[model samples]
Target: MTAVQGFVRQIDLPQIHDPRGDLTFVEGGKHIPFEIRRVYYLYNVPVDAERGGHAHRELEQVVFALSGSFRIKIDDGREKSEYWLRDPRKGLYINRLVWREMDSFSQGAVCMVLASHRYDEGDYYRNYDDFLAAIRVAAE
Candidate 1:
């Protein structure tokens, strides 16, 4: 557990190479700590465009770069870290109570996310200040 950033770390997915092509897969509860309840992808983003400027109250996720590359900045109210995602066979795990921002996308960057929960607006802290407050409440 990376306390400061709520970043569990990078997890390598199962990969299989074949003569025709290659394949990589992730299994919920088998490879990841949570069962996947949602799946989403981001694509066609401008290089300088930023995404994800909030924190989750009780959500977990794994981010993957299905194509191209990008950078994600994570902050858990105290510390910050930057990660690059360029491998399709790897995923970055993010725990709850963490703030994240995604930017610096390369050309044709395609970001895929596997989430532990379905959409719930109340579970999100859309503002940094709110997130900090929630973090403090959680600590107590």
Candidate 2:
């Protein structure tokens, strides 16, 4: 096993602006670093409410704030950091074994997540304490 480090990767997306709104584009293995196997979005969220209280064992994800702004909290057990996602054309590339929580959403905030794997219960560590312990053990 290898040690985990928390980091954010930003991707520049192709955008087109019109009278209505701006359009951002993404294509698997092109604009996005990995082929997207699953797609999900979170909306109608309350302010200061946290979500995604889990870490994936092997899955890779790219998170984008499509509509509004939010804060992303990332932890590698040994260290933790927080990032604000406000740009629709940019995304945060989250690697494996890093715990993440999304919170501080503005009104009508839409968060889109592009995943590299299908849904699997076994791949997720839902408990924060368990995630910390696992990271500590992996670091030793």
User: Which residues of candidate 1, in runs, are more than 4 Å off?
Assistant: 1-5
Query: What's model 2's TM-score?
Result: 0.86
- In candidate 1, what are the lDDT values of residues 13-53, reduced to their tens digit? 98899999998888898888889999999999999899999
Cα lDDT for residue 14, candidate 1:
87
lDDT of each: 0.89, 0.86
Give Cα distance to truth, residue 10, candidate 2, Å: 1.7
Least accurate stretch of 10 residues (summed lDDT) in model 1?
Answer: 1-10
Please give, for residues 10-39, the per-residue lDDT of candidate 2 as tens digits.
778899989998888899778766789999
Q: What clash pairs does model 2 have? A: none
lDDT accuracy of residue 4 in candidate 2: 35
